[model samples]
Target: MKDDTKIVHVGRANAKRHNVVNTPVYRASTIVFEDTQQMREAMDGAVGDRKKVMFYGRKGSPTSWTLEEAMTELEEGFDTVLAPSGLGAITTALMAFLRTGDHLLMVDSVYEPTRHFCNGMLAKFGIKTTYYDPNIGEGILKLITPTTRVVFVESPGSHSFEIQDIPAIADAVHSFSDQNIVIIADNTWGTPIFHKPLKLGADISINACTKYIVGHSDVMLGSITAAKEHFPVLYDGRQQLGVAVSPDDAYLATRGLRTLGVRLNQHQENTMKVATWFSERPEVEKVMYPALPSDPNHRLWKRDFSGATGLFGIVFKQTSREAVSAMLNSVSCFSLGYSWGGYESLICPSVVSHIRTASTWRYAEPGIRLHIGLEDPEDLIADLEIALKSFNTFL
Candidate 1:
């Protein structure tokens, strides 16, 4: 079935609920067994079995399982694991694969907290990390070593928005090493709709369901979908770490998944309008959006992704810090916030130099990231025009 159809039908229609359209949230902690033999099976390695039977609350409930199955269908993976937050899913994936004395190749333009995890926790655990440029492609082979165990990538990165060559990197890792090296991608921005990293040859794909997957900014959730061979390790690690999401949050995320395809299309349309408007403005130096033809990574995006979303960046030509602040604060419709991929629009000034280590941010102009929402494109453009006037006054 097509993706849009799958969005509404996969999770709810196939659910094993008793003649109900939606899976009922199972708030479970202690699962009762009829006999000692049943309890023994649950306590033994049989708990690892893929059967839908509940062993413990920390493992998962039916509500969370419903979401996981839906994500697995979308991601085209063997199974999926849930976490309380995006960072939690990221750390879990990293820890599950890497061990002492292992080396990791991380893309430089990854999310700030991901960089923090590599530099801090992974470093402390003796797993050395080498940050490579996001556009390296097959040249990533140069960074790999005999001990390299994993390659972590994020396409159209969190702030800088550089699209990576996932298939090239994945093939390079497999050809260069026979150690069962894993290729992991933070698929939050692309999600499964636009880009399925697993199909692009990645061993695992991850997402912060808090953003677009939740559709609203109400709940925090994360998901990690793994290929068949890699699913065992990730699943075992999640169980060992006791990482599980709230059942109520899972229900909300499931509901959000139903409308994700339509919502993302709207986000793409709104973002294209705003980003194109920024391109024509005299004050704007550049608009960094992969879907834009003039963008540096447009070709790569066109080759890999089926669509684009709301997030994109803009750099002002000759704006000062004060002017940037004034512009951001003056916007009537766009709220000043960090998180994106919600129904509401948001804008934030970016300082890429503060977070990156492998490469330098060359753009000297003041930069801003925009998350265009479900509002009318004309209204958002008018709000930006007003903000620019305020910025000019400050300058």
Candidate 2:
């Protein structure tokens, strides 16, 4: 089925309660069984079929399962597990395969918090991480050591916006490794609607459902979808970590998911209009969006992705911090804050040069990340024009 059709129908078949179109929230903690035999069967089912049978509240309820089912269908994976937030999903997936003394190959452009987990928690656990260039492609084989258990890739890396060649990296890891080495891709930016990591050879695919999947800023949730061979371990690890999402959040995420296709379409349309406008501005050094034909990574993005999201970065020309602040502060429509993939537009300064270790950030000028949102493109442009005028005045 097409993504739009699947989005509306995937999890709704058995989700309805009393003929309701949407799944009712099942607030559960302790599930009561009819008898001791039933309880024994439930325990066995929990161990054997975690998705279908819920022995306890932490294991998951129908509400959460509906979302999981929908995500699994969207991601084209064997199954999926839920987490409290995007970072929780990443850490849970990492801990599932990693152990003490293991080496991790992390993309230099990974999300900042993921890098922190590698340097702080994973390092504390005695695991070694080697950050590699995002554009390394098949050359990633050089970084794989005998101890390397996982290679993490985030295409269009956080803030930097470099699209990693996922297929090349995954092929390299599988070809070079004698032992089982998993390739995990963060699909938050290139959501299942745009790109399917599993189809591109990744062993595991992760999505910050808190973003596009939720389609709003109201709920925080994440999903980890695994290949068949890796599902058992991923599921066991999530269960061991006691990682559980609130059913309320799950329900809202699912509700938001229904409009994901339409919402993202509008987001892409609005973003293109805004990004093109920025490209024409003298104060803008570059509009870092892969969807643009002029972008360095556009060829790869075009090859692998069906569409682009609302998020993109804008690099400013040589400018003062005060001028940038003036622009950010003067914006009436775009909120100066963190987080993206909401109905409302947002803008935030992104400085990644200091945080990177594997590759150098050559641009001396700072950049602003923008989430174009669902607002009318003309209104958003008018707002940005005013902000840019404010920026020029300060300059």
Please count the clashing residue pairs in each candidate, in the order shown.
0, 0
- Estimated TM-score for each candidate: 0.97, 0.98
lDDT tens digits, residue span 198-263, model 1: 999899999999999998999999999999999989988887788888999999999899889999
Residue 131 in candidate 1 has what lDDT?
Answer: 93
In candidate 1, stretches whose alpha carbon ends up further than 4 angstroms from where it belongs are: 13-16, 44-46
**Model 2 stretches astray by more than 4 angstroms:** 48-51
For every candidate in turn, the CA RMSD to the true structure comes to: 1.4, 1.0
- lDDT score of model 2? 0.91
- Please list the C-alpha lDDT of all candidates, in the order they appear: 0.90, 0.91
Relative to the true structure, candidate 2 reaches a TM of 0.98
Clashing pairs in 2: none
| lDDT per residue (tens digit) for residues 1-395 in model 2 | 99999999998876556898888898989999999999998899888546477688899888998999999999999899999999999999999999999999999999999999999999999999999999999999888889999999998886988998988888888996577999999999988999999999999999999999998799999999999999999999998999998999999999999999999999999999999999999888888999999899999999999999999998877767788898899998899878998899999988889888989987755678899898899999999999889888887
